[model samples]
Target: MKRAQHFIGVAVAAAAVIGVTSLVGNDYYLRIIFMMCVYYLCAAGMNVLVGFAGQKSLGQAGLFAAGAYAVALLTTKTEISPWLALIAAAAISGVCGVLIALPSLRVKGPYLAMVTLAFGIVVEKLVGEWTEVFGGAQGIYGIRPITWNDQPLTSQQWVWFAVVLCALAHLLLRNLLQGRFGRALLSLQADEIASASVGVRVYRAKVIAFVVAAVTCGIAGALVAQQNQYINSDFITFHLSIFILLLVLFGGAGSMYGPLIGAVILTAVDAALARWPSAQHFLYGFLLLFALYVMPGGVAGVFRALFKERTETEAGEKSEEPPKTTRIGPAGEGELLAVEGVTKAYGGVKPAQNVSFRLQRGHIHALIGPNGAGKSTMINMLTGVVKPTSGSIRFLGQEIAGKPAHLICSMGMGRTFQNLRLFSDLSVLDNVMLGRHTRMRNGFFSSLMGLPVAGRQEAVTRGRALELLELVGLAHLAHQPAGSLPYGLQRRAELARALATEPQLLLLDEPAAGLNPHETAELGQQLLRIGRCGVSILMVEHHMDLVMSVSDHVIVLDYGIKIAEGKPAEVQCNPRVIEAYLGVDDEDDIEARETCPPSEGRRDAET
Candidate 1:
């Protein structure tokens, strides 16, 4: 349904373009339109990397220059067909993108920006210095125009060709963004840590985004070369790179139509200001500032905000439903997770040392100690986010100590963070959808081609995600952004997301840390319900009441070593457990507690 809507929208847009082109037949107007399309294509390509993939690259000008020169050199010197040279230009630019991305991957933020900026300068200089092929700073001229079937194409025809290519590029990019790779890029942009935890290969995704962006830019470069029948280093300058970046930002980075809107507006302004040279620069700068101040989210963002508000208003009229309670089955009896001789040290400080424990399936097992007890460290090791110095972790009989977090998750181990690693920018449903990503077996091509299997998989995943949200009492907030939810609700949503992976073993780190007593009690009940549903839970919690109520077994750790382990009742009375909690023991009080009735004794011991 969404695909059909997008196609219809594109068709309408194409018709509008045709109408505008036919009505405005002036050569200057035609040229401006053609330039606008080319600019849009370039800006859209950059958006894929900076907006979606979350990588900053200022080297697009270098890739664009490479593509232009490739076409110029091939057509002028090698007698290669212009069409064939265009393909070669895209391929060469893509290779350059890979080369640039390989090193840029190791650097990020301002450093990456500097590296790519340097790349652009280097390419420009190289083109000027290598005069033999490039025709020096004057550039190559008299480049043969593209022709079809031995017929010379007119200027208007070339303009139409550029427009069609631009439209195709826009459609292709929109489709790519709607697919798996697009989701992965958006996921990375939203939260790299959470993305990696869910098994997104961050480096690989960034490189692919870079290459895809370069390829699109290369195509745009070829069109420009064909349109002009001449090329020069000035056409692909550092300023052009900055201009494209600004276009992307002004259009709204992630929106498909942002680049088109930005390009048309900026290009028209530039063309209009051409006669007034004195004020052109200042006027353009002032306009850019105004746009930045008035529409920071850009044109696309304005529409998105309006759409979101309308959606919320409509949803507000729906009947409210009570929170759905989880229906967990009986806790499994066998061991679900095992850590043997696991040790980890950081700069000689032992965070976890020889930690060994077995967690029973379907049980809420708590690992508690003071601030430095390695409780969190142990959890990290088990989840594959951190590697143990020496030890092995097994989940359901398979070793998973040093594997990537995503692989561990794929093996049915799901975890929530103490600091809240939810994708705050995504809606509640989208957040949970990310957890179900591994279950999606369809590839990028499969989604683009809209194969039957991919369609079924997408539908199943969406339904399952909705069900998981319902299970956690968050279905009502499905459309709400994760960051906007109340803290307690956000935590619940995180739990729902983890469960969406359908893990056999769930690791929750402090699910009730900041909740009020009422909320804590509700959380305890939820944990018990989850345990009943056949998910073995390993929890690190400071709330003794919540832990004692839900946990079937408890393991005590002190200064990176296990102090004691037993059933909740047995471990509560152990001398070391008392010392770990209270620091000092009262012998008379211990005896008094031991003498009390079992239920009363447990309550007294808890206090």
Candidate 2:
């Protein structure tokens, strides 16, 4: 049904384009329309980099210049066909994009802006100074127009060609962005840390965005090469780059039609004010300022706000219950993780020291301690968020202490953060979908091309994401942003997202940190349910009541050292647990191994 609606919208837009072509015969009007299509082609891809990927590239004119030169030099020097030139231009610019991305993608935000801006200035100055072949500031000329049937294409014909190019580019880009590839980019923009935790390659996504932006601008530059039959440094300036960027931002950065609508309005306005150059400049700047200041969300954003989807109130229906899981026992031989004297030091201070423990398959093992304790550090070392020093950490019979976080995640372990790290801007469902990144086999190319495997995987993940949401009792709000949910629901959403990774062991850090008594009770139920899904759990928490209720085994840490490990009752009875929580007067007091009554430590640990 959704695909059908998408096709219907496409048909409607196609009809509108054909209508404009058939009725408008004025040569000047056709030129404006052609320019609009040119801008549309470039702006569409800009939305991906700037809007969805949330990386700034302020020097797209360099990419445009690369393509433009590819076309101009190829056509004028050799006798290459103009259409062939266009394809070559796109390829050349793609390489240029990769070159820029190598260094630029290493940094982000204003640093990226400086890199790209430098790239643009360098390209412009190079084109102007290399007078021997480029004709310097004058640029290349005598370029052949894109011809139809061996004759130069008419204004009407060129406009139609541009329209076709714009339509095709828009369709492909829109398809990619609306799929998993786009979702991952959106995930990156929202929170890089959260995105990485879900297995997103942060730098790779940024590079892909830059490459796509370059390819589109390159294609647009090819069209310009043909239209004017002359190239100049002045034409491909930083101002034009800003103009193209404004087209995306002025319309709606991430939306499909934003570029098209922005291109049409701005191109037409520029052509209309052609008689007065000074006024044209003033009005153009004013419009950009107006779009940025008055309508910050852009034209498409404003339109979306006006016609936002009505909140769906229909409750989510329950599906068949998940089958119960087997909880491993301390006596069981199926051990999932073993840490032997694992320790992590930061310069002078050691947060985790000589810690050792083993978790059996499908067991709920809890790590407990007070604020300054080393529980958090131990979990990080286990999950590869931090590497250990002078110790061994093994998961599934393999050493994994120094592996990358995503590699550990792919190895069937999932975890949540101490303070909750949800991608607040993404929809509730998207958060879970991103968690399945390691499960996906498609890379940027396969997904960008919208291959069958990518599509199949996407559909499968979407269904599974909804199912996970349903499990968390949030399927009804799948379309809503994850951050907008209530505090308790947000935590539950994080659980669903983590579970989406299909891990053998789940690590939860402070899951019950801020919940009320009633909410805490609900949390206990949720943990029990999750345990029944055939997954083991490793938790670092301070909520003693909640921990004692659910944890089958407990490990206590204090000042980076393991104090005790046993069943919940045994750890609760240990005097060291009390000393760690309430404090000990001297280092010897903790080392002396004093014994105390069971009830005293249990109450203080709970407090």
Off-target runs (Cα >4 Å) in candidate 1 are 142-144, 275-294, 306-308, 311-333, 449-453, 585-607
Tens-digit lDDT track of model 1 for 203-279: 78888888888888887887788778888877877767877887887878788878887898888887887788557
Whole-model Cα lDDT of every candidate shown, in order: 0.79, 0.82
Please, what are the lDDT tens digits per residue for candidate 2 over residues 371-440? Answer: 7788878877777778788799889899997987778888888889888889897888989998998888
Clashing pairs in 1: 328-532, 328-533, 329-532, 329-533
Off by over 4 Å in 2: 275-281, 312-333, 442-446, 584-607
* TM-score of structure candidate 1: 0.91
Quote each prediction's TM-score: 0.91, 0.91
* Cand. 1 Cα-lDDT: 0.79
